[model samples]
Target chain A: MSPAEIQQSQNNQLKFLDKPLQADATTDIIYMMCPMHLLTIEEQVREIKAGQVLSILTDYDGALDDIPAWCRKTGNEFLGIYEDTDHYKFYIRKKAPDNKQNV
Target chain B: MKTIYMDHVATNPLHPEVLDAMMPYFREIFGNPQSIYEPGIRAKEAVENARASTAALINAKPKEIIFTSSGAEANNFALKGIAYASRNKGTHIIVSKIEHHSVLNPARFLEKSGFAVTYVPVDKYGTVDPDDVKKAITKETILISVIHASPEIGTIQPVDEIGRIAAEKGIVFHVDAVASAGNIPVDVRSLNVDLLTFAAHQFYGPKGAGALYVKEGTRIVPLIYGGIQEGGRRAGTENVPAIVGMGKAAEIAKRDMQKRIEHVTPLRDRIIDSALKIDKVTLTGHPERRLPGHASFVVEYIEGEAMLLLLAGKGIYSASGSACSSKALKASPVLISIGIPAHLAQGSVVFTLGEGTTGEDIDYFNETFPQVIGRLREISPYAKGWEGAEDPTCTVKK
Candidate 1:
């Protein structure tokens, strides 16, 4: 099942992680807003191989909703978010090529 | 009467190619880049293409450039954005005394907001010493901004050395390259600068277009925070036509910079050599290490405005100090900072060359300028000497 379908079945409860997830790559978009958060994720996700996690750091409050929504839309797995002191670190694992949604 | 424009530093006429590139965007291609439709997509493509060209001129990545309205706006953004973004890391900032008011005013504003700012001193030639920059650093130093060159004096600072010092301490370094970026080769990597400010008009592009080069991974708070434009760092409907013109200008500047420099340097040298022949006309800024197209000096007996008007009458237009300081009729802070007495500072005159500047134009100026000074000095009471004039506190070396 795609991440969106699993998220729907789980009643849309956001998965909050206790410890930050290990990721193959990281990007910081702190203080950047709106589509940048989503656009950066889309761009970074394509670089990592299937099953490799990509971590994004941002301070924009909107990312809390947009990132997970983007994961659901793109069929990528959202590992969860790690709350930093000033910003949030979001982790997402790239889906296998067969299941990856066309960008 | 022939009009000889000697104020390239003030601004430049748009190149024919740049105007041609911008023509379409003013009417038919007028779509919002944020829109999703076909016209909007086309507009977005134009903006991105411009971004690439602008970035290419500076050897920066396309994503690193943020479009702004003018060089002043970019200067303000660099100072305030970095100051606020790095506030949590520290509260102290360092800037040179010779910075443009755009940078200086913002630093002053930051000072009022509880940040400690140290305005570093400059040498008599208006050049900042990198060792002084090193000495001013504190554990709380978060950012250091210095001008790449003085628009008023045309003195180029040792930004590469200052940038290296900033890097050694892991501090964010910003350079106000509005005066020097396209006029000279400015490589962010080679200079070790984290952010740089430049304007299109300084390179024969439209007046309204400018850019800030924010190196990748250098986090900065947005100066204008409404929309998602400029990757969410600067927000407003894009000035599509102006930005397009700037891109074309940048491309042309990159291709023709060496030729332009070669053409202007000799003409500039002639102006400086001729002007310095008149007694009491002292050169400002570093003689050999200055902008290739710049010639600036202080005429002892005549006021700069008087020289400007008399020269304008003779069809040779020039400026006195910066556009702002000249109009204020006060001694230019840059002159005062460099230890020129206030009386001498009033006589500051600047002549900058451009692509259109010709040998004939320089010859005309060379003959006319001395005549205008002579005329101003003849009618002046102090032409003989400043009998009761305030002490000539000038620290300039003979």
Candidate 2:
């Protein structure tokens, strides 16, 4: 499938949270567009242990679909996103050592 | 004849040590910082090291510093970045009247873009009253930018007090420190600034390198958007050699700032004192609360360019107000802002000393400057009086 089709399917399955969840680490990439949101998530996730949550803040609309799809592809838990005033907070739980899959 | 360079504020000659530090990056270790190979890894390491050293100069964390191409670029980025980033929060911005063109032009640009900009006034000494800044704050105010020191008039603004007021109001504060940083000790923590702009060339580093200190957690929109360079804030291929030179220069500036101040202050004072002895020559900016190496004045009947030309002939290179005002042949707005008459503003002359400046250079400058003024005034049409043009008009020929 094309990237747009995959994003469409991923958007349908996105979980929205009413409130912010606890995260072991947080990286604010607000106003940074495109691949930065995804690249930052991958870089920040590696620093946290399995079952630890990494929160990414971004203003990019593409992250609404890309992050969740990224979690699905990498076998990590895609936690719900909390919508803020001007941006979104995406939470991802790092997978256990054995459960982690190569992208 | 021996040449003496007194235009340090315009740009400093690159220190030999800085050039030596930057040499390897231009040739053998030339690699894109984003690559994962050996050359690239070395390049990345060098860039990070430079970032750390640059950050250390201002007592900021490495992650908070974003490299730009020049001080003007950094200033533009700070103003436009913060203005755009906080537009949703508020649309009001405040800047001092004596700011550099980089700051003033950006503020003017923002004004045209539906943002409200309040240009706060300065005193006769070109000092911005913190009280005036406090009074200008409105509910819509989201950012306050002020120059740390005026390159034209040599006046240092009370940015710490303004920073306090901004902090109390929860407004983002940015300072254009292109003229002050590296010459003076700048501590971001003590200054209470959210963003500060400075350049490498001002501190004996190569041109085409500058940095903006964005306090951690401050959200700013990208000024140049292309890659993830500079942490996606300022994206362009890093000028590795220039950045390395900047790092070395910053390290040296931090190490030798106090000694430099001690070295140049006396010579600068000598220039000011000698110039003030001439009839109709008035010192500009605060007498004591100014940059250590900076001395500026307005000579009553002569034009700054004529003085600059005559002085250049004597093998003494100096500046006539800021580079913009000098090239444009206009009375500096900074001089006018400080209550100098428009005719007098045309006579604005600025001399900035550096580590290389000696007592003998000051002696030569002091002797030649008064002679230059006398010769210009001898031929000046305004020498007799401004009887017909006594009004504070801005036109030079009027």
lDDT tens per residue, model 1, A1-103: 7776765435323667788888899999898888789988988988999989999999989988888887777777788888988999999888788864664
Q: What ranges in model 1 sit over 4 Å off?
A: A1-12, A97-103, B390-398
The residue-level lDDT of candidate 1 at A14 comes to 60
Model 2: CAPRI class: medium
Clashing pairs in 1: none
Q: For candidate 1, lDDT tens digit of each residue in B187-257?
A: 99999999999999999999999999999999899999888899888999999999999999999999999
- lDDT score at residue B245, model 2, on the 0-100 scale: 93
Chain A: TM-score in each candidate? 0.86, 0.85
Model 1 DockQ (Cα-based): 0.71
**Model 2 residue B81 CA deviation in Å:** 0.8
Off-target runs (Cα >4 Å) in candidate 2 are A1-12, B390-392, B395-398
